[model samples]
Target chain A: MPAVIADGLVKSFGDTEALRGVSFEIERASVLCVLGPNGAGKTTAVRILTTLLRPDAGRAVVDGIDVVADPRGARARIGLTGQYAAVDERLTGFENLQLVGRLFHMRTAQARSRARELLERFSLTDAGDRAVKGYSGGMRRRLDIAMSLIADPSVLFLDEPTTGLDPRSRLQMWDVIDGLVADGTTLLLTTQYLDEAERLADDIVVIDNGSVIARGTATQLKSASGGDRVEVTVSDRDDVDRVPVVLAGSLQAGVEPVLDHAARQATLPMSSTDHVVPRVVRSLDEAGIDVVDVVVRRPTLDDVFLQLTGHRAENDTDADDDDSTSAAVPEGAAR
Target chain B: MTATATPTRSGPVPSDRHVVPTGATWLARDTWTEATRHLTATRRNPELLVFATIQPIMFVVLFVYVFGGAIQIPGFASYEQFVVPGIFAQTIVFGSAFTGIGIAEDMSKGFIDRLRSLPMYPSAVLLGRTFSDLLRNIFTFFIMLIVGLFVGFRLEGGLVDAALATLLLLAFAYAFSWIQALIGLSVKSVETANSAGFMWMFPLTFISSAFVDPSTMPGWLQPVAEHNPFTIVTNATRALYNGYDPGMDVVWSLVWAAGITVVFAALSFRKFTSNSK
Candidate 1:
């Protein structure tokens, strides 16, 4: 069985449906990256998987344990690090780990030894005796992750682990995650950073409006949407109106020039390099049209998201908040 | 679904045992840690330590010396004897408000969220807090006991009765801390929990027979004053101090303590779990 399986998951908070029929699977020992904007059912999904919240409908299994029926069993096997660091401010870094160890039923001496080991592993041995309130944000986050691993849970859920960290700190956190993956831990990470997902996830699941809009490897999703995109910038604003006439014959039967007058650029969709760019350049040259620049680029995750959902990933604040809610995309748009 | 897939050795395999630490044990350890930490922090700030210790002492002196002259109890030999135990109960009960205020501070600082995420026993949050407050109450009780002894108050009851009296007072105070825990968990702000906890406590203390004999009160208010939990506890403590057998009131006070602990614990647990959801 897969390490994690969620089927027909539906959740609603009062009048708002946070998740609607969301489903996915994470293979054992693989990193499954859940990507979406804020308010995307990412946090909600994490909460349910962690046994912190119960879904109103649908069933989920973690490590072959039913989440709803055997939540405690599931909880025992899973580790969760929420968006905010949950370390005790009053306890020193060592004490926080010790406390968690004790809670996990380890003997006092065992807990102490484990605490020391973790303190050293997280590079917090020097500050182990100091109160967490004295630690920096990055240090606290590291400690929070250490606390979660005290029990050595099989499944790990990290919700926006690097949301507020600096680039350096973010990279540091990524390295820690990489280390965990190397240890054969099944990780389910929720992130808004496309690069983070592309670099870390073995499989990517894109959720919008509380539903899985797209799911596949990064290359597969991008290629499925369109392999290549050619953008043309006109030399003059007045020349933008002539784009359609200039490239009319070279364009594919279904391909249309998307003119953005304000930006003085026109985008042409193409399946492959082939003769499309050459044909367009020949046609524009024959019309005495001066082209500033023309470039072909592979489809990014953002483009796939925009094409499949009809909304830019970053600018859609609504998708950010209601990440699990299904977006009302325009009909006949890029799937 | 591939049923025969080998159980991979990637991450640590968690146990099937659904073990959760008991509420009492979890709270005892966590609260001790937190209380000691708070005490350490307070110890560093001499001003805070001075104020925390002095405020209860001031209450002891003001109530026994200043108010003793103006009041008289029909059966009691001296007002000092009657007022000292009352003040002890009042001071400890009032101190219980810190449980809620401390929780509020933790909530505001996001410390409560951190605690919630841990696999620790769920009740540990409130239990550790209340237990810590109970320790502080014990210290406050002793300080007042010494002050009471200096002011001509004597424990008529033998060592056992005196010990029982102390235990009863601490139990009641500990129970009251749970009430504060509920408030801390529900209130919007730590300052609000501070004021609101004290506001509610003042009336509970005043309405009881903490200050004077229930017989001395008007006929209309007699029943409430008689049945109030604080009344039973104070009367039991006074009886113990005066060397008189407290009889049924002691048992009733214990019952009240146990009942309140269970009820408030359940309520706080419900509030905590729901908030996380």
Candidate 2:
């Protein structure tokens, strides 16, 4: 049986349908990354699977227990780390972990030992005695994850674990997550960063507007989005307008190349870039366009978003509010 | 799926060690653990405790020194003896507002979300908070009691009566904390919770018999003051503290405390458990 299953989960907040028939499964001891832009129902889906919110339709099963029918049993098997660092600022790091351990029904001695172990595991042993209010943002996040792992839950859910971390802290967080993956823990991670999904996820589930638009390995997703692309950067600004026309003639009769006028570049999707690169460059040169560079590359997840939804997957680093209830703005809607 | 799938190791899993205590023991342990979380936080932030006591201390000093001579009750010799118990009831009841503020703060910070996801009973969070607030109230009550005595207030009642009176006031405060919990869960932000919590309290505490005799109020407002739960509790505690017969006030005050507790606990628990909506 799968370690986690979210089958046709549907939830609505009044007039807003936050999730519309979302479904996925995670095999035991593997990671599944739910990737989406802001307000794409990633948090809503995670909440449902974690038994935080009851779905209006369908069901979720975690570690062989039905989440709705036996939420307590499911709760005993899973742990959650939310978007915000949910540690009590007044409590020390060790105290925070100890409190969580006790709440998880660990005996006092067991709780204390587990607290010490987790504090050291997170490299917070020296600062374990100090209040969390004095800790850095990175320290708080590590402690938050430590608190979740206190009971050693079979399944762990991290909701945008590095959403607000600095670049260095985010890398550190990635290393921490890497260690968890090494421990063979079943993880369901939600993230807006495509690279995070690529780096950490065993399988990536791409959600948009409350639906799974695509799902697979990173390479599978890139291939499914479209094969390779021939990108040309022209030297002159005026040459940008003519680069696409030449590429269209050489590639196909009516295929339109994606244009970036300001960057002086145009990208055209092609199934095979081997035979077409030189011909495309020759065509552009004949059209009197000064080609600065020509490169062949596979599509990024950003390109996959554009292919599937007609817009780039926007990572809202500026948005500080929890995204579970963010408005379900349509793809490509103005920010 | 990625290429880094680790070979499933053979070992004892963490879930195997989980032996959840059944029924009442589980509830008791969970509630105590949750309460300990808040109490430890309170101990760490002594400045918060000091500030919490400061307001009640000021109220005791202000009423006794600034407004004491101007106000008089018919039966009592000095206003300090009559008003001190009222302040006790008022200060503790006012302290119940922290219950709402704390709940709202936890909710805003997503700590409530963390608790909800845990395996413990849902009641533990609310019970733990109110329990910690009760302890904090007891601490504040002692400070006020000391300050009240310093300002010429005396406990003329026997030790048993004084302790019972103190228990009744704390019970009423604990009951009020449930109502505050409901308010805290209803508000969207901590700022809103703070204002919503204290807005109606000023009238609830002042329009009653906390400072002066209810009979001295305007004719129309007199019945409202006389019937306020704060008045009943104040009247009960004051009678016991001043060595007077409490008549049926003690029974009535207990009834109010029990009734508010049963009704508001039901409401607050429902609000807290179903708060995902």
Candidate 3:
């Protein structure tokens, strides 16, 4: 059986549908990253799989156990680190870990030993005795993740785990996640960071408007939209328009040309780096038009997100507003 | 199913099985850790500790000494003797508000969501908070008891009766903690929780026979005071302190405590699970 399988999951809060027939599967020992805008049902999906919320329709199984029917069994096998740091501020780091150990029914000595080990592993050993209230944001976040693993769950659900961390801390968290995946742990992570998904996920599922918009590996998704980005800079601004016409099969509508009027230069997109670049160069050479610079680049995850979702990831700040409004307003008022 | 050949350990014995806990045991361990941490937090904040114990003590002193002269009891020899047990019951009942306030703070700080994500039992969060509050209530009860002794109040009942009374008060306090938990979970802010809890508690305390005898109240107010759960607990506690048989009042108080606990626990649990989603 797949380590995690969510089939046509449909959930709604009153009039607003959070998840609309969302479905996916993750192989054991692999990482599956769910990417979406803030209100695109990523967190809702994680909550359902973690047994924190029951779906209005459809089913989810984690480690061969039904999440809804046998939540206790499913819960026993899953570790969850939610969007926010959930560590108790009043407790010391050691106490927090030890508490999770005890909750997992470890013997007093065993719990202490495990707490000591995790504190060391997370590099929180030095600050283990200090209360979490005094810890930095990154330290508390690390402790939160550590506490979740105290039970050694088979499946881990991390919902926007690095939402508010510094660049260094985010990279550190990525390394920790990588180590967990190396140890044959199946992870279902939801994140807004496209680079994070591209780097970490074996499979990527992009959700938009409460539904799955695309699903594949990073390469597959990028290739599905457009092969490669071919940029051409010409010496004359007017000549850039003629290049698209010269390059057959390359649509002028899809070409975004930027003209530098002061230098009389224009740039446009090309189809294939090999065939289109040489053909355009020869065509331009034959026309006595000088080329300033030419380069071909692979499509980034940002490009993939835009191609699949029809909106640039960076420009979609409305997603955050949607989430906050959806969360704050009463369900009845939403109607 | 058929048995399969097992591989032998290559080096040191694998302690993973014993080291890594799972299932119900894990939840039990987590709850204890949370409960102990909560207690330690209360200890470290000496201001909270002092206030929790002092407020009840001051109330006991104020009712017994300052107002004890003005209030008249028909059968009781001294006002302090009649009201001290009542104060014990009243103080702990009022102290129950802290459970809600603490929960509200945890919710606001986003700590409760962290607890929910762990593999611990869902009920553990509520249980841990309530248990910690119970311990604090016990400490507050004892402190008031000592203060009551110094101020001329005595427990005529032997050790067993005193113990039973203390247990009864704690049970009631525990039940009230669940009610507060529900409020904490439902309210929008921690400040609102404090105000709402105090508002509810003030009337509940004043309407009961905490400061004076129920018989001294007007005829219409007498029944309400006589039937109030706090009044029943206070009457039973007073009887226990006077070395008098508590009789049926013990059963009634216990019934109220258990019934309210079950009802409020169910409500709070429902709210907690729904809100977590």
Candidate 4:
């Protein structure tokens, strides 16, 4: 059975319709990344799937059990790491994990043993005895993940777990997540970070304005956005208008170039970036078009996002740049 | 159905056998776990325990020492003796607000989300909070008694009545806790939780028979104070503690306790179920 399935999930928070008939699934032991911008119902979808939300007009089945019908059943087989670290600042890392263990009804000895095991796995053994207030952001996040993993859940729901971490910390968290996936746990993660979706997601579902707009593998999505292509910025700024006509004419009988006048660049949609470059260059020479620079670019998920949603993801990477630029950033910005 | 699709790699067959007890057993365990967690924090945060202790003592000193000389009870030997029940009523009433603050803190801090995602128990968080605060109230009652004894507060109703008074106060506090829990769950923010938690306290406690005999109040406010639950408990506790006519106060105290507990517990549970989800 599939680990998770959400169909036409709908939810509203007062006047805001947070999830508008959104749907997706995670196959057992594979990652399904719910990729979206902030406030795009990513968390809402995870919340519904994790049984923390009851969708207004949809269904969620986890491990073959309907979530709304049996939230306790769904919860038993799933682990969730919310946007916040959720670690008790006053409690030691070990104590935090131990508390979760006991909350899960593990015996005291079993809880302690599991706490130590998770502490070791998360590389927090030394810091385990220290209050979580003393932990670095990454350490706290690790503890949060460890707490989620205490029950060894079959399906894991991580709702933007690394959304506020520094790059190094983000990577460390990614490593921990990678380890869990490697151990054969299915993961349903939500993120606004395109790279995070690309890096770890086996399949991606792009959600926007409380709906799923696109779903596919990363490669499929990038190509669907418009595949690998050559971008030519003409040497003479005025020649930009003529370049597309010249190139579309010489390259193929049916090809068309999408031109950006402001940038003075014409982007040729090509089957392969490198394979078509030589032929395009020969045609450009024949047409006597002098180019300032011609480079083949592989479309990133951001490109897919722009194609699907018609806007850039106001994301972690750009926000991180602004944050490190000025120390006035009181806390890490959310992705 | 997005989830009904094929599995790429099915997880191992029941890799971790869940032998977890369900129903009441799981709930009791979960509640106990949360109670211990709160108790641990109470122990580690010496400042909080000290503050919890000092605030009530300060109230006792202020009311008995500063305000005592002017205030008189016709049938009482001393103001301090008459004020002990009032102090008990006020202490536990205010202490009940901590339930709301704690619930709100858990929500803002995301601990409620963590607990919700687990399968062990549904009412565990609420019950655990009430349980822990009850323990603290018990502690506060003991402290207030020790300090009351020093200030010449006597128990003329004898030991059995005193023990019964303590139990009534605890029950009253437990009932009030559910009211706070509802506020906390509704507010769901640490800042708002505090204001919302204590918002009803001033009007509820100040207008009651806790501090003074409701007969001394102006006619307009006297009825409200007399019928108020805070006044009911305080009156009952005073009767039970000072060897007075235990009468309707005892019946009304338990009735109010049972009524508030059942009503607010149901209301809070309903809100908590939907809100947490």
- Name the candidate that leads on lDDT: 2
Kindly list the per-residue Cα lDDT of model 4 for residues A205-283, writing each as its tens digit.
Answer: 9988898899998888877777765778777777888876766643323334656766677766566555566777777
DockQ of 1: 0.25
Candidate 1 residue spans exceeding 4 A from truth: A223-305, A311-335, B1-52, B65-79, B101-126, B150-152, B187-192, B212-226, B244-248, B272-277
For B1-277, candidate 4 gives per-residue lDDT tens digits of 1111112232321223343356665677788888888888887778769867998888888899987999898888888878878988888888998899888888898888889988768788899989999999999888888888888888999999999999999999999999999999888478898898888789999898777888988999999998888888888899889988879888888988999999999998899887734
Better of 1 and 2 by TM-score: 2
Candidate 1 docking: what grade?
A: acceptable
Tens digits of lDDT, candidate 1, B99-158? 888888878765675565455555666766677678778888888889888888888787
Give DockQ for candidates 1 onward, in order: 0.25, 0.42, 0.29, 0.32
How many clashes in each candidate? 14, 1, 10, 1
Tell me the tens digit of each residue's lDDT in model 3 across B55-150.
878988888879888977876889998889888888888788888999999898767866665556778899889989999998999999999999
Positional deviation of residue B242's Cα in model 4 after best superposition, in angstroms: 1.9
Instruction: List the pairs of residues colliding in candidate 2.
Output: A202-B1
Tell me, by DockQ, which candidate is best: 2
Candidate 3 residues lying further than 4 Å off, grouped into runs, are A223-306, A311-335, B1-34, B107-119, B214-223, B244-247, B270-277
Q: Give the residue spans of candidate 2 off by over 4 A.
A: A227-232, A242-255, A270-302, A311-335, B1-15
Q: lDDT tens digits, residues A172-284, model 2? A: 99999999999998999998766678789999999998999999997788766775677788999888777766666445333346777777777776745667778877887
* lDDT score of residue A264 within candidate 4: 73
lDDT of 4 at B145: 87
Residue A322 CA error for candidate 4 (Å)?
Answer: 13
